[model samples]
Target chain A: MRRLNQLCCALGLFALSAMAYAGPPVEGALEKQATNWHAIIMFCIFVALSMGITYWASSRTKSTSDFYTAGGGITGMQNGLAIAGDYMSAATLLGLTALVYGQGFDGYLYMLSFFAGWPIILFMMAERLRNLGRFTFADITSFRLDQGSVRTMAAISSLTVVCFYLIAQMVGAGQLIKLLFGLDYNIAIVGVGILMMVYVTFGGMVATTWVQIIKACMLLTGGTLAMLLAFSQFGFSFHTLMEKATAVHKLGIKLMTPGSLLADPVNAISLGLGLMFGTAGLPHILMRFFTVGDAKEARKSVLYASGIVAYFFNVIFLMGLCAILVVGTNPDFFEGGTIGGKLIGGGNMVAMHLAKAVGGDMLLGFMAAVAFATILAVVSGLALAGASAISHDLYARVIKKGKATEAAEIRVSRIATIGLGIVAILLGIAFEKQNVAFMVGLAFGVAAAGNFPVLIMSMYWKGLTTRGAIVGGYGGLLSSVAFVVLSKAVWVDVLGNKAAIFPYSQPALFAMPIAFLLIYIFSKSDSSARAKAEIEAFEDQYVRAQTGFGASTASSH
Target chain B: MSSAMYERMRGNPKFQELVATRGRFAWTLSIIVLVLFYGFVMAVAFIPGTLGQPVSEGAMLTVGVAVELFLFIFFWALSALYVKRANGKFDALTAEVIKQAQKGGK
Candidate 1:
């Protein structure tokens, strides 16, 4: 409590003094001097509040179940809020919106793919996932199997997904703080890193969930108010806003139509599949299902989540249009839209730039703060999920021989969270200058490649042996990473040098199918793979643990 | 009633009426929700975007986001209906079926 007071006082002093001392840098130096202090202060408040929640939750947690799954006591509504929080990451909040502002209909394709996944998650995965995996995504994949290789592959995939996701979010945090608070990029990265570590280390999933819930509400409120104000700019008429947006389109700058940006059918379709199925395949997202109590309740949570997400994306779509229309009207919005514009980039500043055009420093500061809060909340979840994969699946199972007590596991988890946080901070600092939009795409691609195939096979195919899962999961992981490294997006767009290495940017077309085929082939190879003996033993341990039934009953299968 | 008639309507008269009424309500509620949500989007697209006037872009985004923000409440309403109907109607029928199944009755 004393620390909290000191932190608040320090922030207040910093905000007042920083604004008085800060001066706008010249065009080239703008990135250095544009840190929005208001945003920084707002972001700190959320981080501090989340830490408070984590401490409270940690105190209440008394057992292994409470530590790992929050005793599965979360109400459906709370889970729904967390689900909203989980889905609306920096990628969806900033990347997609920025893409829409610049590219028009092409950007909507991203939202369409993301939004399309919820119904699929509800209908296909959620209920069964809860029924099968009690604590982690690994539970379902390692079922009735040796779990050694499968757990390793899952850990690798989980780490990769979280790393890329953290990079995107952390970079966004740094950029948002720099833009809104006048802080140095390095300081912003360090600040965000420390906050995320504090939240996950002290609180675990409980702290993580509440922060997500609060951020989700703030995001909804911010997004709605922005859209409403955008409409009011045109007298609350959708037609007028469309007319303004369309007129801007007529100036040979198409922001509302699809073909204007994509230009190729293959790229468009692949990008679409990547976004849609990719959301369901995310380890962080799949982990949220375990936090809920029952299989039946899991179904209810997803139903609500889908509806919320579907509507949320629709509003974001309007905000995207508003970005171009309002910014289109005020040339000042994009004094830097191009080579000579005030802002150098087209994507990151769409939300902030639009807010400035509509309101002023206050609105800009508030939106920027919300964006920062979004990044902090998301990175904390990613770090926590990754920590669980390490401490629970690998450390507890392998090193401790599964005899590690709950207290021991929690200790390991906290240590792992701190380690991951340090890595995230370093990566955020390293990649802060690169285009953040690509980071999101890379995260999705990696997840789709590594984890999705392994998960799908494990749940549906009873014949999927441990060997098949290990090979398929690892194979997907390596192939996707290799493909991404060679792809044009990385070589030419990111590295700014071009040579024909990998013909395709998107590898899901080749990699995902190969992953599925490998799993199928391996699952069918050995007669012993279908051994009824092992199935009975495996069922005795994990399946019954989930059903809340006597563990011994399943031993007879 | 004869055993055949009792089997057709179930052993309990109250259970039959509840199923008929709740089933209708469930279907109607689902359809209404589907239409309302889809209608909201269609209207947003055709009704003139909320983007062009004197309002702040943040406010516009907020309003647009709010439209979807209420999904939690919608879900709460759906869950309430489910619990109410399940407790009021579905559970009773389930109990009757269990009793019949246990008795080895048709």
Candidate 2:
């Protein structure tokens, strides 16, 4: 039971973390290719299964509580699997493998950075978040502060992050489908948009969570099958795998250690900090904490999720190494029958090529379907999160001022989900040719600098005031955006400038401090009656956060 | 929660103990993760060659891969350790604290 429970959870987070590294360099190389009928057939089976789950889920989603958090009745084991699904992505499998296939150990280092964020969330933030939050993270952010001001800030920041991330995924889904499944780019974008909307609008959190869980299982199975098959050829020897991989690879022995990818100390540390705190601030991931029954379940889910993330990182790492030996030397997998030539669909197709090499057409078809399913699952999670930020935070709390009925709030969220879906489809097509890889990085930056600082301060600090949170939140948001704009990723790489104005590609190291400083200085100086009451209210918030007293309970209905 | 319930919980000794113990444990584990992770990051940034070297003479596995493998298992073990303690001891204390506070409220 323990192993089964943990297995489901592990598969989920591994999928979510994969999305972070779908880099521009890999996604840019996608060219329209021949439709693999096997891939398309397998993909249809996956779609049918998920839609069936959605049909089952729509019946249980009745109230606002059901819509946002599955009535908070989900077990830790299932929550772990569902939430983990939100983390793993097509980009993670394809991008990380490409990293290993090309640069070797730096790929492992990149995966390590992504995995580092999970533990901190598990240890420090999980219980408090589960105890204090209800439908959205805004509930916690605005728990003590003036709801009108703080919720608005959280909603804006969340929507900004969601929009950027949605566009990136949508564009990624379009290109990846066109390349791997032989579908038209527009058709793929519209397909993803429609599916996400249907799942979120009808199934709500229950459907979205189950979709993630099923996707996690499929991805885990396909990846493990491919990894095991590839490893068997090496006589089940890690030494032989590394030896043969390095011998054939151009990087040779250089792939064994960290190289110039993150050779600069400043960028390495900054990128580390960005990924760590940025994950905690993500609206979608944070929403998962509230899915389980209580703080106890929250802790259990974290334990399982972290274990899965770390374990899957190793799986992806081994798969990358194995690909070097199996796919690297074979001229048939490359363009123009050249061993070192551009991979047929792009470098991101290394894992797919590796799949075909090891397990033949059947396994290749299964992996291709898993990759497509991965995108849809992630998009649904993001859409639900965005919808909650709108209907729960912006609409119900801000406009209705806590007077809105449950039915009205759920109605608003369904409409908002559709609204977000339409905008995502439009933006996906609009940015079809552009490199939107920076969008994911920018999403992390906003989460770290904008949402993370204030959320942490509110949970742990007693002196946080509404004025301080607003100023600090906006300051962090603006500064992080400004820094990313001037940084090398955008300033030089995207904008085609001579040099970057901001030296570091990551803005978190610098932006996080400015946010904390502003919040501290502003909060300390506030002498208003409202500030005094907010400070005193911290006592009850502390009690609730620690003991789950008076917190949202599992819905009986 | 009402102010009276808040006051009752604040005065409850078990509540105080749970807070102190859980707070300390969480931060301690957090610091451990921070130190270990940043240490790896620093090594990767500054001393790539040391990790590039083999674990021993003529060994195929690099120092980097071995250490990474260790960190992988060790970090997850830390998480399990945390859940084991929190779900057992701290949760029991928390339940007791809430019960006592509710009695005082009635």
Candidate 3:
């Protein structure tokens, strides 16, 4: 009975999370459908291929450098593809498509904001990041500042951002697996957790990089093929496609206009800020710079990544429009014959249903597998970033005072991977009823507020002291989280409250400026000897950051 | 390298030129992106009705979509331009500055 009660709770969590995105709960038909054999077969193939890569990478992963940065052997083009793969998660593909399907012009804003970050990264952070940081982003912060305190704060912020990101991915994985495979939500969560653990614990960055690259290729191919098929239905005419989409959509021409979903100006700007700055703050994305050979390669990687991402987003925009005409109006996708009723699976499953509509069950199955692979790759990257923060930054640098052996550090990282995987699965269950896309937004909010300010200030501002960084980071972290909890989205909608204290859901607009102001005030007022010395060292650090003198080199091993 | 050599490199005209040129270029691109993106954001906030208007008479595409598509292409072009300049001009200057610094150390 106790075991049964636990099972019920897990199932309830899964159902709640799934229902939030997909819409009105229709648990009966989903459970009645048999396991999708084609999807299962394709998923198996992907797992086998990724596992083989992991085995190969485990053999070559001899030292801490190999485990963290793939021994810095990855080429610029390949790293670019891997970075694209890392950024374009299942959420971007499925969630954004659903948003477009539900709210037309509003979704394009998200795509624009998401792409906006890449150029910023290329212009500002990429080259300097490559020149300065070693294992983790904390390396850059601790470079000229007080190492002990700064690393601790950076590690905590990284872990906070990573865990939020991990929960989003895990929840997404559970929901997608349940929809595609007809698997129990609890089982799906466990499956993703275990696969992510295996990849990060044994294979580390090398295997993760290859997996991401392969997945990117598959995703691009699948998305392009879907786009071709979608366009073919309208005689390959963009005008006809738009006309058909408008004709079918209840909103008519309004579908082509903005302001349907994002009616609130403050929320729109706040959300925009979250996405624009958040990508720069993502530890996993920053960590990708360490995998490249040099600053030039790092810059090239962002260039290629931006190009690929821009192209992919363009295709996604068209695909979403197509899904509206194809999947949205199709009577077969409706739970009943009623047009305004629930979709067959949910709104989130629109892309998959459109794939089936265009290319039949085979394409649908293939797309499903690709979506699953997307979650796996992203979660593995997030788990690795979190593990590195714990083991590399906290355990080795802080606890051992940088005396921990390479072998010991790697061991701790592997252990941290397992621990994080478990924590993610548990959180995935807890937050199952919450909207995965909104959860991702909150993650971005925290990252933009917490990590972006400190990182940017530390890199650019000479007045940055260890106390300033710590206080400002915590200020951003706590304020963002507190604002989110108090916001209308969480308090009123999720928590069943009467009203929210915070009007807007996204906190980056207010939290980010507050964090920057705190850092500036603290840094300027700091009169300690250490702060003075750190200020004096800024010129040397700046020179090294620009010129790449004494930058860590790729090991021949 | 010694502090004297570091000071020499820092004081070098070539090094100063490299820093100034690169910094100016990066900031220029950054400011452009900031203006374009935040302009669009603010436009969306204040006068979204203008953005919602069609690009041309009898055209289905709204100003918002057309402008955004234009921005996307422009962003890629700007990045490519930055990369080309960095790889060619900036890198050449950087190499020369490093070479002079090494000579001073010797």
Candidate 4:
């Protein structure tokens, strides 16, 4: 049955490629094209290897600890790669590539700021986070505050970020599968969804982490090689290439030029804040810190991760530039031979189209495969984080009062993983047609607003009371979500309808400040009792985590 | 006071050194990366192209690709260097610290 399914998929992909070639060529593009069997085969091999790795990791996981954190045995280097894998999702690869391809230097700014976030994560938050939490972000934030309120707020924060971010990933999955395997959109969504569930459900954090590591290595390698090939095409003269690219595509070149590219200052600032502060608060990214053996290891992992992530984004920026230059000359690059039709009118499709143009069928196929794997790896991580919040934080901690056995907790997490996968699939399908880049930005904004304040206070500030943390976390999450929903980007671009709910499109200016205020005010109000309890807990956890002794005081749901 | 000093020195000299080495490396790396990254951005903004070159559009494109590839290799080398340090020296010291910090039986 599986072989037969594969055969049908192959035939369908051929038909779609043929159809795309038959269409009118996009402007200033090449017409020559061929079916890229090498790219397709390469993609399949990567997916197979990832699945095998997940299976191996899952088979060894028998208890909750093994499933959720691989018994915290992952080496610093491995964790670093995994962290890189987790953060550099399809959005960063394909979408950013397209943005550079279409827009120019402005795209490079996003890459710079995005990469800048890593140093901030490594220098500021990583060690502290490892010292404070176990599996979920809540483990740290709830230490000084009310467990119930913190968990509730954490759940909301996790759910909000996952739901919003999942939209982009799922949509990317659908588009990628359709483009690569020629599968129907609905079928592709369900297939990708089911595969992610299988990955996280059986393997848990162990599987997710390994998959992430493998994907990151492949993405970095693929991106590096692509950039090399691209530079060679230009004879290593960046000046000449830029001039030629500018001369060929004036609008694109202008966008690449600094100072006048961004459409709005508010949008740029909003995005900057989202990338800068959001790295510390993302639950999936934070969970990777716990899998390292100790606080020191956690710090090392982030350092390695920053290096890997920095290089990868730099390569991706060049890749984006290459894609624009190459695709600009090839009229038949995109489906139906029209840039807008092929590109979905956004920056995301630029990388794949450019790959097809520069490297022909083989590189294009490989690029598509990498993009697809990126979606799968990220969706799996998000699903796992969301499930952990539900099973460990909500069910085991709140309902059972930490009485749930390891076996039972693992089972609950598995079930939640499956459920979350389904939810992601549904959201992906619903928002598949929209320009959903802002969904990722929305996730970042919410995380920064809702989770960062509470987490920072719980770790460093003893006066943070339970009420204060809860109020701060939940308040941040709610206001961000509300602001995002009402933003012009959400209403006009996503919903395809215009509404004037807020004058500004971005909400961080208001939401983030408000979150900080709430936590500060509440912490001060109940400073006396909260201070004593939190100081004791913080020191205890810090010593335990630093020395690598005792069970992690940071409880898992 | 003597025990505290002894503990600090003995517990993990390698680990402590690793931490300090990384700390310094991080500062150096950030400055270098920022300079390179933002330097390129600023140069592109401020610098003018030396027009009238003989290279074809395609040839020029190939050259650009090579430079980008070289940058990637530089990054890979940077990471491999860190790993080598961690594995050869840092890990060795960390293992020693773990052994010394072991309970009475050891």
Instruction: Give per-residue CA lDDT, model 4, range A228-248, as digits (tens).
Output: 888788887677667677676
Specify the highest-lDDT model's number: 2
For candidate 1, lDDT tens digit of each residue in A128-214? 577677667887787667766677778878888888888888887877666556666777787778778777776677778888888
TM-score of chain B of each: 0.59, 0.93, 0.92, 0.59
Candidate 4 docking classification: incorrect
The alpha-carbon RMSD over the true interface for every model, in angstroms, is 10.3, 1.0, 1.5, 7.1
Highest DockQ scorer: 2
| lDDT at A516, model 4 | 80
Which 10-residue window of candidate 3 chain A scores lowest in summed lDDT? A17-26
DockQ (0 to 1) for model 4: 0.10
Global Cα RMSD, each model: 8.7, 6.1, 5.3, 7.1
RMSD of 1: 8.7
Error of 4 at A167 (Å): 2.0
Residues forming the 10-long window of minimal summed lDDT in candidate 1 chain A? A548-557
RMSD of 4: 7.1
Residue A356 miss distance in model 2 (angstroms): 1.0
Model 4 C-alpha lDDT versus the unseen true structure = 0.69
